[model samples]
Target: MEIRQLRHFVAVVTEGSFTAAARAELIVQSALSTSVRNLERELGAELFDRTGRRVVLTEAGRALLPQARQLLAGAEAARQAVAQVSGLGAGRLAIGTIQTLTCVDLAGELAAFHREFPAVQVSVREAPVEELIDGLRAGELDLAFLAPDARRLPDGLAPFATWQEDLVLVTAPGHPLAAAGRTLIRDLAAEPFIDFKAGTGLETAVRRLAAHCGLERRITCDVTQIGLLVDLVRAGIGVAIVPRRIGEAAGLPCVRIRQPEPGRSIVLAGRAPRPRNPAAGALLDQLDRLDRFDRLDQLDRLD
Candidate 1:
């Protein structure tokens, strides 16, 4: 089978639909269909069972799926090897980030990485903490920056590095409670809370902290986007608990909770013992140095 055909077949397998795969691969659906059809003909097996509005991998497809992915991975590594021999770096590295730490000096670090490894192509995807971890497990991402919560981590994944920031209760400048100092969980239990939705790192942390304090929060609204949550709080919809970085950057009034829950942390995590690309390994080393936060000032930087 042609490498192009295998690529199309793998895309279809991963996406579970020819149409979606075609859109992602930037090709016409007809072309993607023909390629998969040709691949099936070559393999003498029906890879996917066609059912109404759903594509299910047949037994044959299941058996071949891992091999297909391995083949693609090997081909990519070979390409990178050739580029390395030719005195340049070349590979596509997919990265994921949680919404919480995006406001940190992430851009500066990325720019430095790109400057040093210009030949490496980087693609970044941002999702909620749970979804980001899910994507990493599904091989959709090479690396991820995540905020730690109370949830159990996936098997084979380990936190490589961490940065800490206190959780802050925030409201708009005009809100009556904006000036409150050392707020208590019990005090805010009855007030409307603008909360992050389920499965996010912030949401998980909030749930854990509430449980520890023996309090049940009254969540009046749930928002998925961090920026939108800040706006909602600014509009006086409700108060929110968020990382101090986001609250400060938004210029919102923030107070540390009395007997507050422990601060949150950003972690660099990935599958342990997985074969990592050289460039990826290097980036991880740089991240571990915590040099990115070093220049931000000692008071703001976590140890």
Candidate 2:
């Protein structure tokens, strides 16, 4: 089957509908359908069960999914390999990270990378570490900056640069907790808490810390954005648990956690065999030069 046909098929499967897939692929729905039809004809199998409201893979489609993804990823990798020989004049880079990423000036890094490699199309997504892991394993992401709650990273990924961060509680000015010096985790049980949604690194850490301290927190709000979370704290809605660096950057009162401190690991990682986009490597090398990371090579740490 043609690579374009396979791409259309895969897009439809991932997006869950031909309409959405066509929109994502920037092609007419009819054209995308025609391509998938041709692919199915060549394979002599019905790839999708079109009877449902949300399109789903049929048995044959399920069988082809992994191999199809691998083939597509390999093809893209080869194309990028060739493009980089011309100094990254073409090809795309897809990087993912969590909203809590504070170790690097991500926006500034992207802007600089854009100026240096003008022709390369770049996209960055802020998502939960779990979804980022899925993207990495599926080869949809070139690289990711993740704060994994778990110590051991999932398979099919390799760690590069990593930063270990301490967790601290941030409070509004004049809040009772602000002047407490270092607060114990158990002391936060009665306080109003602002937290991120479930599955995020920050939210997960807060949950784990609370659990370890054998106390249930009084959560007042579950926010999705870091800026808004900090703003809520600034408005005295509640306090939040975040990495020490982010808490400090918020310009609010940051209190350390004592009696078994809370912490998480921030790591730059990619697909284990290596990433497809050469731009990912270039960006990592630039980050290395910036002296922001504890070299993975030196520590030989993964996860």
Candidate 3:
């Protein structure tokens, strides 16, 4: 009838005597006897035949034995399921990212996390920064890699890490800006630009930098794909401001921005209160470890 009583009954049957089961269970013999008797009473059936010196199971006892064992096994399995999630052995993690994030190797980092926590399911979604932030705030995403304005991060979001990266001007070969070794922000004001589509962090950065220079960006073409933007620049469609790493990789002529150079702070952000995903927490821990090791190595190089 009760789990404790079933456990006591099973122990008595296994030990072949009430005295031995009581000893095995670390309980008084009378208490063990009372538990078995209560179970039998609740079930309205006799569980044991006590006529002989060696007690044996009655028909009802044999019928209940397997079911009792199953119940105990089920209880144990439930506990183990909870333990797995609590220990970060298994769960799901939904992570979001912007289109441009060259500062960290996101794929490599995810692969490392998968190796360490093979049971954790990882899902990655790539979108513009604004949409990623919206997903984070809506609880649809557990973590996000973004370029958040340091002066105005969203209300309930917190940054886990931040790094600075310069944005360079990429133009077609022999373009005036590319021919010049250095150019100011205002210098590009009148030039036609190939820029990221609206709602992108890069687009916002371009606008901010232009506003700082007291100029308006003359956007000739807007694109959502980085590769297409680079191709457009290569084809002489228009010059564009992009992350320095991207420009270098595209082999486009890159000109340095001078006098309030364009740049952005890349951030790994999550909801401020933190979600209750053990897998997400584990991934974050792995990232922190790698970041700390990198910083320590940098310090060592200075020595």
Which candidate gets the maximum lDDT versus the true structure? 2
Cα-lDDT of candidate 2: 0.85
The reply for model 1, stretches above 4 Å from the true place, is: 9-65, 83-88, 102-104, 137-139, 148-153, 273-275, 288-290, 293-303
Candidate 2 residue-wise lDDT, 2-108, digit = tens = 88888888888766799989987889999999999989999999999988787989999999888889999989988898988988988888899998887778899
- Which residue pairs show collisions in model 2? none
Better of 1 and 2 by TM-score: 2
What is the C-alpha RMSD, rounded to one decimal, of candidate 1? 4.9
Clashes of each: 0, 0, 0
Which pairs in model 3 have colliding backbones? none
1-303: candidate 3 lDDT, tens digit per residue: 787898799788756899988986789999999999999999999999999999799999999988887785455345445746567565667799888888888899999988988877677778888878876765557789887644556778766666677999999988877778679887776788998978787888887888888978777889999899999999998989889999999988889999887888777777775544566667777878876323211211222
Evaluated at residue 263, the lDDT of candidate 1 is 72
| TM-score ranking, best first | 2, 1, 3
The stretch of ten residues in a row with the least summed lDDT in candidate 2 is 294-303
Indicate the worst ten consecutive residues by lDDT in candidate 1: 294-303
Please state the error at residue 120 of candidate 2 in Å. 1.6
Candidate order by decreasing lDDT: 2, 3, 1
- What value of lDDT does candidate 1 attain over all alpha carbons? 0.75
Higher-scoring candidate on lDDT, 2 or 3: 2
Query: Candidate 1, 297: how far from true, in Å?
Result: 25
Residue 16's lDDT within candidate 2 is 72
